[model samples]
Target: MDINIRRAVIHNVSENNQDQLRDTIVDAMQKGEEKYLPGLGVLFEVIWQNADEQEKGMMLDTLENGLKQT
Candidate 1:
């Protein structure tokens, strides 16, 4: 089986409104399932591509702090 995960993820959420998007993300994280990781990665890829330096720095800092907690 062949699958384009990034494309599929984008397609699934591209039309979502802000509230819907937030719900989707929150639900995905709350579920804590391995299958959801790829979708999150795709979302993060979009964020990374569009984020400015300051935003990127903040994201990295947040990720760093999150890892420290584990």
Candidate 2:
């Protein structure tokens, strides 16, 4: 495979670790903030930029519902 493709595959795998896509988004946010706990607003931006429409919708619904249940 091409180097770029290989890198992308590896990155996607790392992002999808833990069986929860949210972890990837959260990790990105944390990195941006240079901290352990990520801010919700930054997380939203990172997720929005990276996720497709379907994934974005799913994540939004999941997060909203999860929030409501709290």
Q: Which candidate's lDDT is highest? A: 1
Q: Give the whole-model CA lDDT for all candidates, comma-separated.
A: 0.97, 0.62
Write model 2 residue lDDT over 1-70, tens digit each, in one string.
4455434534555545454666665566667765423344444555588999999889989999999999
Alpha carbon deviation, residue 46, candidate 1 (Å): 0.4
Error of 1 at 1 (Å): 3.2
Q: What is the lDDT of residue 58 in candidate 1?
A: 100
lDDT accuracy of residue 45 in candidate 1: 97
Runs with alpha carbons beyond 4 Å of true place in candidate 2? 1-40
> Candidate 2: deviation at residue 18, Å?
9.7
TM-score of each: 0.93, 0.39
Best by TM-score: 1
Q: Tell me, what's the RMSD of every candidate?
A: 0.9, 8.6
